[model samples]
Target: MVVLAGIQEGKDAIVEEGGIVALVEAIEDGSVKGKEFAVLTLLQLCVESVRNQGLLVSEGGIPPLVALSQTGSVRAKHKMITRN
Candidate 1:
């Protein structure tokens, strides 16, 4: 649950390759924090990470992040939608 712990810790700036991949895996595996608050917290971290680093478009992070952005369980899409 490092990813969940990470999000709760507010360390969104560390969405590096390994971290993002881990989060995505957790999300996909249904092992991460399933609570809406936890998921939304992770989502916010992701969005802010991309916005701060501008890596969403340049580093092929968009596709995966877009997929991550579409968990379909909340209203995060309204704030930052990714449709790749």
Candidate 2:
């Protein structure tokens, strides 16, 4: 939830310091809520920083997000699409 709040407040530095790689990991292995929040946070972070967007794409964030869009819960899929 801290990540969620951080992103909502436009705290990209906080999120980046917390680690974009960690967020990618969460999207890969965390719970549904975790994945959703991670994706949302990444989306927000990416919006504010081209560097973060490049990091996400380079870290293999896309495939999992694509996979999640295919199989994740409706809400998760919705967040993925809307946020991306």
Top model number, lDDT: 2
lDDT of 1 by residue, 41-63 (tens): 34555543645345334445456
Cα lDDT computed for each candidate against the true fold:
0.44, 0.75
Q: Write the per-residue lDDT of candidate 2 for residues 20-56, one digit (tens) a residue.
A: 7887888889999998888787777777677767888
Worst 10 residues of 2 by lDDT: 1-10
- Using Cα atoms with residue i matched to residue i, what is each candidate's TM-score against the true structure? 0.35, 0.77
- Over 4 Å off, model 2: 1-12, 15-18
Q: What TM-score does model 2 achieve against the real structure?
A: 0.77
Give the worst 10-residue stretch by lDDT in candidate 1. 31-40
